[model samples]
Target chain A: MGRIPWRLMFAHFRRNKLRAALTVGSVFMAVLIFGFLRTFIVGMETSLAECSANRIISASRLSLFAHMPKSLEPEITELAEGKAEITAFTWYGGIYIDSDPKHYWGRFGTHPESFKKVYGPDLILEEDAWQKWTDLRQGCIIGSDLANDENLKLGDRVHLTGNIFSGEVDLEVVGIYRSKVRSFDQKTLFFNWDYLNETSKAAGGRKDCVSTYCMLLKNAADSGPLSAKIDAAFENSPHRTMTQTERAFQAQFNSMWGNLPLFFGILGGVVLLACLMVTTNTMMLNARERIQETGVLKTLGFTKGTLLVLTLTESLLLCMFGGLLAMFIVQSVDGEILMFVIASVPPSTIWLGLGIATALGLVSGFFPARLVSRLEIVEALRRRA
Target chain B: MSDNALLRFQGVDKIYKRGDEELHVLAGLDMAVNAGEFLALMGPSGCGKSTILNLAGGLDTPDAGTVTFGGEDIGALSDAGRAGWRSRNVGFIFQAYNLIPVLTARQNVALPLLLTPLGSKARKEQAERALRIVGLGDRMEHYPNQLSGGQEQRVASARALATDPRLLLADEPTGDLDATSAKDILDLLQRLNRENGKTIVMVTHDPAAAERAHRTLKLDKGRLVHSTGAAH
Candidate 1:
């Protein structure tokens, strides 16, 4: 068997610059959309995956909208039976120190000791920042993005207006933390729960109330048994409790995107189908133009198999070039948009784009390659057009 | 046309069918060429002259009868087998100089030899030798687009001679050339036949071109009707 003439095949692409550009552009767009859709899906899922695995969330039996009594914290913690651990936090729903209505960051109030125990080690901090965070009474920990966005750093005093608490609270910025996990660390601001509770009591609001408790199973494998025990302990309480894995808790937030994945899947399929059509059209035109060349090859001792492989190789080369271009663009731009859109994009999304481009090349090249292989050499040679 | 016959076509017929119409292109044609003879197939357009050359070159199969090259029945062989046979025993020159546009003249000439077991270095040497034979040794590095029409056809001739095939099939080798280039190509074909003992079968509409062959056979209505030559 003769060696494949790869240079000859590439020369065909080089000779027809406009046609090659159009075909490659179609492939680039296809891969770009594929990468975009894949990144969104992976981003949403990563948000759930990045949730603290050691943290278990306890909410109301009915829904997250229902609140639990602060009095139940001790009862829930006692049910641990040395095989579980616990911490508690409340959603603060606070606006930024800046007056802009659109300036929102994740704000939560938690017991300082338990919050530090569960998350302190993972929150890679600047030197002395962790000590300052633990020592100061009015200090709040903010994400690096939040600090950068508001120009707030260590020892900067800032006032946050709580939407749910109905008052402005003065807090000193003690530390800035970046996410070890992609999702949680990027958007949160943490303050002492006692401050909010004390303020609510002074304002004659509900005193013995908190939103959620986070538990840690002693053995990761004991999550199921520990969850069942926690739920059983609070079964008949005035405010009933629901215990679930951290993943399920985060997934509740994802449910808000309802039917989005399905919509994106359908949209992605349409884009890929359009890409296939464009690729097929381009390949068909290519095959028609090279009929005489193929005939020449056939007469020069190239078998149908060789012809098929060559044509398909040419198509795959075209698509792979576009795939690389798309990959470059996505790698360059996806990080910034994703940080704003959904916080972070996963590496798997890039891999998925590459896989999709490969599959697209094969599927799209099939018909045209087959047509070239099955062509009669005499007829093809005779077909001047 | 017995044991020494290099090619034999016996009662060969090719009929092309389009929708409800039948076009009998080669109707029960029988012909034979000796080992070192140069035969010209001459006729007007649509007279199946090219078709005969195509059959003789093993580029197409006869529908009804046997077309044999070197004792092997070409019609009975598979497509790959026919291709292998053509690569080993036949070389073709087209009027338009069907050289791969990107390849240099030497690379184009080396194409048919790629089927041989020769290494790349050896293939290059043989290709250079064939180019030298066609008086294009210095022009071997030039691409088809870079060379003149006559130079391109000479490169095509060099390519045809590269495989050391016994038979050379030229389909109007000078059909796309000027008078000078056409004469150059015909003179090369005559030298290849007389000196190298290659069996040459060419299809041409030009009488001047046909006059250079060892024998000229005219086809009319899918059958060889007239022959003027020493019957060998």
Candidate 2:
């Protein structure tokens, strides 16, 4: 029932400065990658959390590329007993003039009136800007992020050279708004659906079609039944509908990204395995060098169990130090640079990193601790002599 | 065996195998050491002098017969049980003065006391007293690498004496020391046995180191062939 002297443990590490640092460094690198993967998973969860529980999106059953007829919008609105607000948006690809050809922002031709009611006050616009956006045929609303990136304000006209639709389109930005929901992706441009339909028909393209129909319920609990009813209404039609909650719709990107969280998780495991091997070798070397000291400890009445504990505790302390250090470093470095995605290492991820580090210690210390515990005193002393 | 014997070896057999050749180091050896007596064992290489001390300290078990300490067969105990008994009964000093290089002299001396249930502060105080008894009071903070040959041995002796065990076993404790350092170590061991009345079993090749003991037992091939300055 004797207590381990933590000072002795630290002394061993302190004496072998390089080996200790390398071991701690190995753990840090491994757990940092592990924590980074965990952060990505957390970021995905946080993004999903922004989706309103009451909102649903109805897309073409086969693919997002397949179009649904605009006639379904009126039918869905009539089916609702004053309980639903419906809107529709056609996907428009907008490439800004005088910008990088590789980069593009989403442009959508959405029903203006219903879009305002469905999306709520997160789409903030001045009264004049709102009126101009609704009144003018060529008027469009830009997200705050897009306006800031292009250095535009209300009434500032932007020229876009379209790639998907062959045209040089000039649209005046009548409003700039921000979305409270992160999954809504605030780098978008929205114009009136009638303007898009008339322009597309003039350009000899298909008319009366949109990519998706979005619905918002007054009571969030009506989502499941309303979704079923909406899907049933068009199930027999050529443009069959697939209705899902907004969160589930956004989750489709997980497949688009090839389930990056799983890939990152596997990468984290590989890094941890590599670190475990390196740290295990370092621990074995430390143990080998201390055979005489272990024999001395045994001769002084230290039991095999006690030696094992000391060895394990030494490694555990190293790993814990590395894990906490990585947490601190990641916290300091996150969101500082200009990146496409701002991934955050949450508090839970830090705790998880510590747990992983503890497991690393247990695994890495096992061989060395067992070797020391089972060493014969006569043989161990003879090793040095 | 005498009733007052602190340690007894009855018909002890020890063997070593080197590449399929069996070297019989000890053959049915019997020995007894009385309480509070300083007994030195001297022999040549591979003579089983250290093997006998190892058995007496419960560090090893004989192939035949029992090694008993304080009327109990220590060789009969389980590994864990023997470790517990050894902690309470025996303190060992090695020839190399094996102090953990990382720990200070005070910490090294306190190591044996750590096996007890005593608090850390009490262990430190007892360790300090042990170091002071060996006249290295001011060197408590020095590490083994920083201390001299004689100082390291004294720190080791302090460690052995710190727990106040009933028996002290030294296996060529002065083998690595210079003549002056060796004499100093021998004087410390003699003082511990005579002044402190501790029962000591020491294995040494040096006759001068053996002379410090109250009696000397000459061993040839693990058999006690002769003795001087004490009755067998």
Candidate 3:
């Protein structure tokens, strides 16, 4: 046994800078893409895990896009039988600023008082702002992320043009609420349902409708039974209801993308395979170029195992460097945009990236190291090219 | 030859096969070199000059008979045992000045000492001393490609002598050098053999190179055909 030739192993990289750079760059790109794909999968899991255990979401049997009569909330509450608190809201789908036609975001119409009561501390709204919002008919609350991004403050007037309704509605930004959950913060803009109804009726449009209802149970364990009861009560109605826990509701919304996460997962795996092949080829080329040197080292009394370790260390160093670079780049990029896309790259993702890179290094370098170690000294010396 | 020679080849045989043809490189060869001897083996092409060096250095084993060094039969040792023996007892010099291109002269000279338990600082100091002995102390930081043919051979010589081994095996040590460089390398080998009391077995085809050794043995086909007077 001998000390590892650390300087010699790294000196090979200096001799073949272009090849080393290409190998490292390929690993960097592959692992970064893998990290993003994994982030999306983890982000969905985090969203579901953060859902309130005591809350149940009730939607139309057709889809969340399908509307139900606002009058049905009382019937659903009766089914709860004094055991739950309920609230309802519909998707507004508003476009911000006429000049920036692509600058669109979520705008939801809700019963503000019930929405606050149901959400409780999860939605942090100041008392003064809450009082202001309740006093005005056209007042709305925006998420802190949206408020900071759009430079909107309290007392600022906002005129949103609805995508589904025929006319524009004027509203006042009375409060900014910060969500405990990051995914919720990036997408929230809540306006009064009564204001929406009045505006639509004044413009001769349809009114008094909501797309979904949410119920908060007295005991979290009763969600399953209460959800079944609520659905059974509305089972024979014209608009049949489908009720489930909030976690399950989020999962359904996630499934609407239809195998996209799975597709990205497969794509990430393919990228990893490509990286392994490329890295293997790079190491093979490196070993071939150093055949004579390997023979010389053997004659200098280096054991076959020492040669194998040296070669493997070279590949591992390259991959580790690439993994760190990719993680830094991913983390240093815009966080708000990443959160908006529902892809949250956590600190643990960096560790995962490094672990995968190390595995890649080991697999890619195995054959090349074996080939180098098994080289016959006479044949290696005789090889000219 | 004396009974207590430092290296002994007894009825040694070596053969190589190329598809269907069997080439008998060395057949029943017998030779001996006493302690502190400078022996030069010379002959025409394909005379098994390098094969003898390989067998003596434990790089290759004979098909039959035994090659003995320091009273032990090297052919009887296991692969790992033979490798350990070579590291502790033998130093080799090749014609191509086979330095690892990526390493500096100091690093190349220090390579053999890596197998020993010497720390990095001690190894570096010993390598520097070896380089200075070969008159290349200032060139220790230069790479093989950065040195001349003569300087590169000096570095190779430094690397070979760095381990202070019991026997030095050289195969065409000056084959790739110019006349001036060849003379310098031959002079350095002769000094190492005579002044340092190191037993050396060099294989070369050059008559002028053979003249520098204390004894010269000529080989044809596989057996020794002629011998010069010896000082051993």
Candidate 4:
């Protein structure tokens, strides 16, 4: 076997500068988009997986937006008896700074007393943060990251303009808490459910319902049976309940925006196809222009396999360089603002993208190399084009 | 033809297919060049002169007869085997001074040596020696684009000589050069043949180029119509 035509192929790129750069750029864009998309899915879903296995989330069977009566909380608690502690969990879509999306963070209305019992294991808080949240009626706890970003501290007043429901709301930042789990985003603002109810009632809107009931089981293994028992108790009521483990509930919550994973997968596929087309087109042009040179090498006794390996390797190296660089940027930079979940992409996801790069390189390299390698020497020499 | 001729073609036939057209390029071509002979093939375009070189160098197979080098049938070898045989026995020089544009003169000359078992140091020594023989030792590090037309051809000739093969094939070696450059290349060829006793088969249309050889065979259509040199 002959050696790889390393220097020759390297110089070919120098001969066609714009084409090579464009090809590499195309590969870089494809890899960057694909990596970010996979990271988004993995970061969000993996964090959801960290939610305690002992917790069960029960929502309206008809729709996530359907209101469930808060009066059934005690009945659910009774059904679980010693098995669980229960709380109300309601999403609050509020604009913190006018309507700019960049200032966005989560706002959830929950029963602060039971909220701690349900989520205590994952929370890291100041010594008196819990007491302050319970002692003050209009007090709320902000995530440590959110507090730091907004420069908010204890006793700091925060104003929110309601978007989903009517009327503005005001609350004091009573505590700054950080979460041990990323899926439970550290940039959320959690307040008492009773505070929201009293504010709405004073504004001539009586709040009688909660969005969902969260039950934290005493034993992790009892989550399934306890969830079923609670749901069965409310099966014949006016508003039916669908109860599931928190992880399953989070999956359903993600599906509320549509099949995000499949959408991103298809988007990534299209980008990759475009990358393949561009790179293959450039490689084919390179191969065609050098057909006579290939003939010259063949006459000098370079075997078909040697030429094929050399050509294929050149293409693969170019694409891999672009791909590996894109993933490196994905790692070095924070994408929390873009991903809206966790910022840091996992190393596993980077390795997976590299696998995609290798496959992309091979596929894009094969056809052009095969065409160049399979030509007869006499014919190739005649092909001056 | 002598039974011990270094390169022999016996009743060789070559046909080319172009879409629907069947072109007969060579028909029953019987030729022989004894060892140490300098032979030339002259003809118009499409007359199978280059085809004969391709078969002799094992770059292409004949449709009908045997092409043998030193009594071993090269056409009978597999693709890989023929490539190996060519690397071991034949060197090729092209009309366009076909040096790789990317490689320095030394690197281009070292290409065929890559097929040999010689270490890098040995290959480098052989390439430099071959370049020095062609009087381009000073330009060994220059790329083909950096060298003149005649100098590039010298580097190509050095590449052809780097492996020290027994047979050399030159197809229109001076077809693309000016008169001065052409003469210098022809002189180098004569010196290699005389000093190294290398068997050479060159294909060219110029009578002056053909005159440099010991024998000249002229082809019209696909058959040899004239032979200016004595038949072996």
lDDT of 3 by residue, A18-104 (tens): 989999999999988988777777777777788888889899998889989999988988888978888998887767786463356
The list of candidate 1 runs beyond 4 A from truth reads: A17-25, A46-114, A121-128, A136-183, A186-248, A320-354
Residue A359's C-alpha lDDT in candidate 4? 76
TM-score on alpha carbons, each prediction = 0.78, 0.75, 0.88, 0.82
Model 3's DockQ? 0.53
For each candidate in the order shown, give its overall lDDT on alpha carbons: 0.81, 0.83, 0.85, 0.85
- Candidate 4: regions farther than 4 A off: A31-33, A40-50, A53-99, A109-112, A126-183, A191-213, A217-248, A261-271, A326-352, B1-4, B17-23, B229-232
| CA RMSD of all predictions | 5.5, 6.1, 3.5, 4.4
lDDT of 4 by residue, A145-223 (tens): 7887789988899888766655667999988887787767778899878877767666666476788999888898998
What fraction of the real A-B contacts shows up in model 2?
0.64
Per-model DockQ: 0.47, 0.50, 0.53, 0.53
- Alpha carbon lDDT of residue A359, candidate 1? 75
Alpha-carbon error at B185 in model 3, in Å?
A: 1.6
Task: Give the TM-score of candidate 2 (chain A).
Answer: 0.70
TM-score of 3: 0.88
Instruction: State what share of the real interface contacts each candidate retains.
Output: 0.56, 0.64, 0.52, 0.64
For candidate 2, the docking band is: medium
